[model samples]
Target: MADYTPNETGSQLFAEKMWLQGALITAVGYGAVLTLYVLAFYLLLSRLDRWNRQAHAIFLVYITVQFILATLFQASSARFTQLAFINNRDYPGGPGAYELAFFYIPVDMLGNIVYVLSNWFSDALLLWRCAVIYSTCRFPLWVIMGFPAVVMMGSVGSGIMYLLQVSTTSPFLPSSANFTIIDSSISLALNLMLTIMIVGRLVVYRFRLKTNFGLSVSQRDYTSVMAMLVESAGLYAAFSLFFIVPFALGSSVENIAFQALSQVQVIAPFLIIVRVSQGKAWSTSTALEITSASEGLGTLKDKVPMAQIQFACASGDDTSMPNAISHHPSVPNSDTTLTTEVV
Candidate 1:
């Protein structure tokens, strides 16, 4: 038998409304999202064609591992926390599978190990991609890419040390000091460096784009492509604030905080995923706009297919002949490479 109600202050750390309403709601929500992530990652692994195959593979693995951790963490947290809230709770009352799983917290540490390492691994992929994208002439093959890899090695090295030494009882609970601050500090530092590197890469990319393609997005198609980047950046920034800010501010280890941050961490990558999936520009609207306006120079139109332009050529509001020579902007190449820079 076990105590169901929120107990001593130390145990209150596990306390959350988990019985009838709140627990059920959380269980359903987390379960649904986790399922979708699993399916999506699998499908992506199957269908990734030209996208950075190396980075995509790393991303898929990362997502898969995160999915597993999320599944286990959700199940354990829900049951343990709900048991905390249930009346007349029981733990070791079961003799079969439940007991076996409940007995192996040390083994479950491997899941946590996967969780953190996968995070840094995915970040390393992004950091190097950005370095390549930022490089003006040829992508930086060794130095810039290797720099992030070294940092990743450091992060992983510290993480393994902390995981091996830490003494956690559950996925939600922090282990000893090595696991808590030592591992956490290293993670935060690496992630912070990653964030800065991403910003720098984007800056370098914009500069390159400006220097390469001119600072002005004169064409309508270019404007549409820029919109996608802007939107994704906003999504990225929002998710970053959710996790990065909390880590920087030293928030408490309450289960609610843990759950909230856990969810944000889980969903953050999907934002990036959607952005990558939506590659290339030249939308229908851009085409329509270009169609509505004459193509050619303002004063004298090009001798190609151009948009309609009416003129008051003293013959009333006479419609100018659909100039056979006037040119309307044509979407250059449909297969244009829309750069999906990782960060």
Candidate 2:
């Protein structure tokens, strides 16, 4: 909001160092979490060998890219801080204005791009699962996803505009801040909507299963899966809010929270992979069984109740039914994707 000045008070330099310290702490935390993510990815591959390997691989790519973006941010921050402190007096001129301007690092542009891309990638992944869940129920896909999709585009546009403004301006502009604030707000809204819509579909689906099949498996197990999904989304949304609230309110924690936000973007999906692989949530085997059972019920809706259909199809022991199912046909790839939401 003001011109770049090298006349920094001791307190201001200390504050900047403190902000960078918080960012360093967040970076370390993310490093530990990224290790967990890699381990989880391996376990997922081993456990879901029979499932869609391509889809899982793609998801891993998203996480890896997010991690790479964070690493870039950390490197940029280190360079920026070094120029600010260690080389503060090395400029041949009286003082270095670019060095004093913390936001002018070229890496910052790349980092911002990465941050925005990672946020959207995670959001799109969740929305894809939502589409799969609702599609089975004959819900209109475009209608359900249309608004958030538009907002996502708006976020990207805003981010690009903000970067352009930052590149041209001597100091931070209110307009640039507005652009980022809008992007963060939209991102928060997208996450909240995804969490609510997905959790709602899951609860409804679980109820239908219980009503039709009558708790053959423990309700607790089923609930635990739903809870895990909800909690992961909730945690991500919570941090999105944490970053935005301080930022919007002009609170002191904004920088620290923003740094942490980058890592949480990776954490939410990685947690899903870990839970699924551990069988604390739905695994590939469980996902397949549910799909087969649901399809069998759809085909024999008039002849047998859902419970009987599941017994005939899922049990694998009915001699009277072909392959223990009255209507045992190969499930199409589209039909096989019902459990994509759980992960």
Candidate 3:
């Protein structure tokens, strides 16, 4: 047992309390994200026809793997909490110090590994989405993705260092702390870049639509603020910023953020998959259709008989309009309903 001043004992007690609070928050968040995961998974399986089987299979596998990782992480965290507060409460320097000292233990190490894996998978998904959204851009895919890919590799390297150091030393030690900060900074930077790219692409598309067609209700469905946030995984990025800042500062607030981060990571990509399954997510065909319509607006109006035009803008497995065009309120009501091919 090591000698501790009164202040040190008080600080350890506070840290233990914070850890318990963080664990509660993690439990709640895990339940909510699990619900979302299930819903997204079911929707994808049910709507296999929306996308190619290969794509659907890939998404299914990705989410399944993520789920497994998250589950293991949560289990490890719970086990550690049990050991720290219940099993080892009387450990020298209190439960909090016990947690720090025993971080290299198998349970805590498992949690750390899975946590890093979750970040990697989540970042990779965001990068892939950015690439898909910009696939039609003048720049080559490699050009746009190359830098972020390199940064991701750096994040991986730093993560490995952090893990290795934590396996032999306390994470609060300077050696492990440095790697932790580096890994987190790199991951955050990558996430922000990918988010900006995706949202920027959608914003440009929205502007083009508004400029070409004036204002239409259907256009909002595709490029609205809510759509942009969801598709870009902006929520995750925002939460990450909230967490990373405090974590880097060595604030206790990081405990809460850290606990919830794994769940949020899963939730972010699950939301995207839900949108894709519902045919509301932007796809290559959707982009091409919008571009064709915008470029040939006048021609379409002149060539197609107005009386023959009927807008079918319903969402969910509807082939009436390309994905993302939910409804068009711009068309004037007429006594005669007609059918015309969408441009």
Candidate 4:
């Protein structure tokens, strides 16, 4: 019940062919960029010891492998489709076309699986960041995180179902479109909620600090974190929406939108690494003296417990990070009490 025939007018056929080529080109281009980011990540980690480098190295390597697999699958699918169907119009209603309609190509199926897995991993990374930020909250943070976890599970289930359904039928099953739509909707909602929550918590924390110490809190601290959260989630949500619109409408551009979506996933994580590497430097304008013996020293020394700020898995150099007050070039301690100044 579907029209997969491209053997129409010369112009129509040319347009279809060009679209296919464009999708392949775009996917490959993103893969190239992903490779460069991975290379840079490795180079950046060279200074840290193996124990510190393990986490970052593992993350980059996993994503890089997925990118490679996605590229290969896309290329192979395009080649096989052309060789078996588009180029051989003599068999317009041939076995190749029929098989393609009734069943999934291994390459295409694998590519879809990889894309879904990529999204799952990316979402998990985002959730981890949110958890890191709110580790010391008095209220139950895990209880709040539970909502996204449920949504992501549903998304993964829907994605897998959609993949299976497409392979089993032509023009998709009656509810197949619903599965894809649900997946995209869930992804967008999850990312949006996570972004808002993270930013909101940071803003509230800043205000609390301000109230605790007579209005000495720096506005930039909270705002910078908010900006980072927006930048990280904005592109990903936008691309998910773009892909969903075309896909829900069954438009021809859905495939191309998917290619672009994959590219955005790669870009989001790459930006996170770059931002962390840049480091946030806060002003040292405030000084606190613990005792008169230490007065006039201009050295405001406070003991921030190691438990308060935990800068875990940050380029294997967590020990190099200074207190949250000074905003030095070092990584911030993860889940540790970062001793800062009230001055």
Candidate 5:
């Protein structure tokens, strides 16, 4: 590698430095979010009033992928750091940090594909919950199958785009990180709207069913659904400013802002989703207030969660088998849950 004296000015160097700063920030933030998410997920799983084992398992997969992707994207930041340091100074190669920076295109591109697919999968998981939520309503079969089929297409398209870029002569698109923001952006918008639409339909159908049954949709039910939607909206918000400031202006500074914006993109959703579900918010709400009344908070004499209650009454049972079998109901702060078992 031959050294060539560079004529990059101070402003150019500062701009590069900021992108590196964003990368370092991403590395640190990704590690922190992954740690907190794991601890929080386990803590949530321990509590009683929550997503069923099936839904919880789906979430387990979703969050796990999210954590891995964030870590990879952060790892990709090292190249930016090198680029920043070598900007004004003479280094080897035409692009002093090409060896370092070159890998970023695929990293960003693959990460974005997985990122989008995971969103679709997450929403599909939500739809699965909807199938459960509206099972009683007998939500039209078409809607059930149709909504998810459409959503899956977006996830598929995202993957195809990634494969296209990977298999092409260009491993990384020279600009825009080889993951076209335009296609990605349109896909994201379509997804958010799709989720909102599907959820909106669920809400309507839910209320209609309740009305027919001479029962109003409970505040608790509404709260649970709203909480889920909030997660989606929060995710969309993460990418909101990125497109607005950077590509909207179509300037290099905007591109620089775009780079930092990418870090925030991963940071916000990872924190919001992982944190909210950590403590099993559904089961532990104060409004439920059931277990709180128990003297030991429902713990047995030995201070365990009393899996089964034994009752031996005066009923005539010749085999010495008890007349009653009672397992401690998994009521939480409240004596009631949505009763997913029944539905």
Candidate 6:
């Protein structure tokens, strides 16, 4: 409540303000993503069928867990901010120093842990989608996913190390910085590779459709550019670059990007789930269907026949009439008698 300005430089105050701004922006972003999660959850629940119930249930549980982790991270972040700016505002070096010195508090630790967990979930889901999209490719699943799987395991290890390092010391310490950089770089690499794989598969699908079925079919449904972007989780990958680049470069802007990256990660997968619930996402059978349809189009058109039927009614009180049905080759002398009652 007292008007006391700490002896900090203008740049230090500016950096602290950036951190606060990032938190506010993250809160707003979380609200929007939460709305999307609710919509996706409702769609998944309402459209459950015997055929897809098991798959839908698995997704339902996955997204629900993701939502819980994101919610906890956000709550812990808000609590830590409150403690720094209000409860300990009068600490020796001002609120910013208080935040830095107490970064290893329980609430902050929880936020870090959940944030890492959420990232791991999002990355795993993206990798799964990539496998589904590329199911019909000539390469074995292990061949396609092998390197990325190793990198993902490395990411998990680095994330655990990062958490351990931060728990005992300030995140600004050199030891914590090494683990932070390694963890973030691995995550960024994993996301980029998965996004590229997914988008690449969709692009190939589009090309095949265009070549075989014309441009119209290629530009519609799952192969469309927008659909590819959404299904590939491109939004998350792009946002990760925004965060990782700045963080790797030691820029203060990383603070803002870091705050909202987790929410974007969740939003990316939620969008994919929405498409899946709508029956428009790419599936294991999609490539096969496209191939079969392309190969059979001419045969189907040549073999199928069009039929015409004619109905006649008596003008007077007669209730019996004969109907003439005709096929493409013309069925001669084919007629059926009909009886009708007028009410």
User: What do the candidate models score in CA lDDT, each in turn?
Assistant: 0.45, 0.62, 0.78, 0.56, 0.47, 0.78
Counting clashing residue pairs in each candidate, in order, gives 4, 0, 0, 15, 8, 0
TM-scores of the candidates are: 0.54, 0.68, 0.84, 0.63, 0.53, 0.84
Off by over 4 Å in 6: 1-7, 217-219, 298-343
lDDT by residue for model 4 over 255-339, one digit each (tens)? Answer: 5666667667666655555444333311122112112212311222233333443333435456666545334334343212222
* Of candidates 6 and 5, the better by lDDT: 6
Better of 2 and 5 by TM-score: 2
Question: On a 0 to 100 scale, what is the lDDT of residue 59 in model 3?
Answer: 90
Model 6, TM vs. native: 0.84
Clashing pairs in 1: 303-325, 304-325, 304-326, 305-328
The window of 10 residues in a row where model 4 has the poorest summed lDDT is 281-290
Model 5 steric clash pairs: 49-283, 288-333, 288-334, 289-333, 289-334, 290-333, 290-334, 290-335
Question: Tens digit of lDDT per residue, candidate 1, span 167-283?
Answer: 333323343443544555555555556555555544554455455443334342233344334322333334444444444454432323334434444554554453344442222
lDDT of 6 by residue, 46-95 (tens): 98774689999999998899889889888987998889778987787666
lDDT of 2: 0.62
lDDT of 2 by residue, 132-188 (tens): 556655557798878867876776677676666556552223553556677788888
lDDT of 3 at 283: 78
Q: Whole-model lDDT for model 6 versus the true structure?
A: 0.78
Backbone steric clashes in candidate 6, count: 0
The weakest ten consecutive residues by lDDT in model 5 span 334-343
| Cα lDDT of model 5 by residue, 187-274, tens digit | 4555456456546654564465445332233433433465555434445444544544454444334433444444444444444445
